[model samples]
Target: MRLFAWAALAACICAAPTLAAPQISALGTPAAPTAAASDPQAAAAVRVAMRQETLPPGGSLPEHRQSGERYLYVVAGRLKVSNLVTGEEQVVEAGKMAAEQPGDWHVAVALGAQAATFYVIDRGPADGAATTAANNDGN
Candidate 1:
């Protein structure tokens, strides 16, 4: 009887359905260009770096400039980016991207009550600094 019971249990277990492997799907295609290099040749010579950044609610990055082009993709929450040069401003929401050209002075502020998380891709000269303070003297 024990042997029969053991066999029955094994058979039941073997007949059970197995779980499927996780699915893989593409997120989506890239959107229209938000920013572009002024010179393609110069952009091609830069090094690429990627990092994840987070800013708490109400936090802000003071007016500054990047040494190279910057692509910021918002993963969560929202960010308000103000272009000091063009007097343009926009709110970047989750799953959206924002780009800043080299030497474009801008300030970013975290909006809403949640912390904003994003992925930053920087393309700059191999030996160039990542960022620099912008001339706030109405330049």
Candidate 2:
């Protein structure tokens, strides 16, 4: 019985598809212009960091600015992000992403009655802070 089981498992494993090279799948198409197009210094090498954050219903992040570019992907629920400089506001839902250029002042708040979970990727100068509080006058 053990030998038969081992043979069956081996056969199943052998029948599974194998990849000859890495496969790439795009998440979604960007609706707005990319940050790289406007930032001339984007090509410079920078430090990168990733983190996951969850906000309870109605939770909010204080207005702040990133020393580097920030990319946020919503894992669950909806998040409302407001850009102080551009006066643009957007709601990013699950499976959607938002990007913030360096020095762009913004704030985010969880929407709906459920907790919102998301992943953040920050890319900035090697010695710069990830985020800092925005000026009171939105400078």
Candidate 3:
């Protein structure tokens, strides 16, 4: 009877579903596409994009730039952001936020032992990439 009970417990444990790990997710479409701003004289509506990302400890997003404005909010852990152009650095902690200007080159890294999770809201051309890699030559 005891052997049967142990086997049943093992089977139940093995059959349990595994939890999925959290990951970055980008949702929805941009409100205005870059092409929509083709007319220089026309007032174009800005596009908005939102995404959530998780950076492993010591991991980093390389030097990059966005075509529009970006706002970052740290959800968990700590984030170290550096401006490649100006050589300025800022540490954003959980519950804190930071802003990035259009065409600004910057890099973000996860600080400390724990991974960091953050949300990004970007406003720019509707169809533009969230970020573009910048030339590494201190340019």
Off by over 4 Å in 3: 1-44, 127-139
Candidate 2 lDDT over 20-105, as tens digits, reads 21111121222343343345444233355666789999998778787655667788899988877777777989877677655667
Q: Residues 1-139, candidate 1, lDDT per residue (tens digit)?
A: 2343344334322322332211111121223332223444443444566667789999987787876556667888999887776777779898776777556678889999999887766654656576455657744
Candidate 1 Cα misplacement greater than 4 A, ranges: 1-44, 133-139
**Candidate 2 total steric clashes:** 0
| Order of candidate numbers by lDDT, starting with the best | 2, 1, 3
TM-scores vs. true structure, each candidate: 0.61, 0.62, 0.62
Worst lDDT window (10 residues) for model 2? 19-28
**What local lDDT does model 2 show for residue 65?**
82
The 0-to-1 C-alpha lDDT of every candidate, in the order given, reads: 0.62, 0.62, 0.61
Model 1 pairs whose backbones collide:
none
True-vs-predicted CA distance for residue 125, candidate 2, Å? 1.4
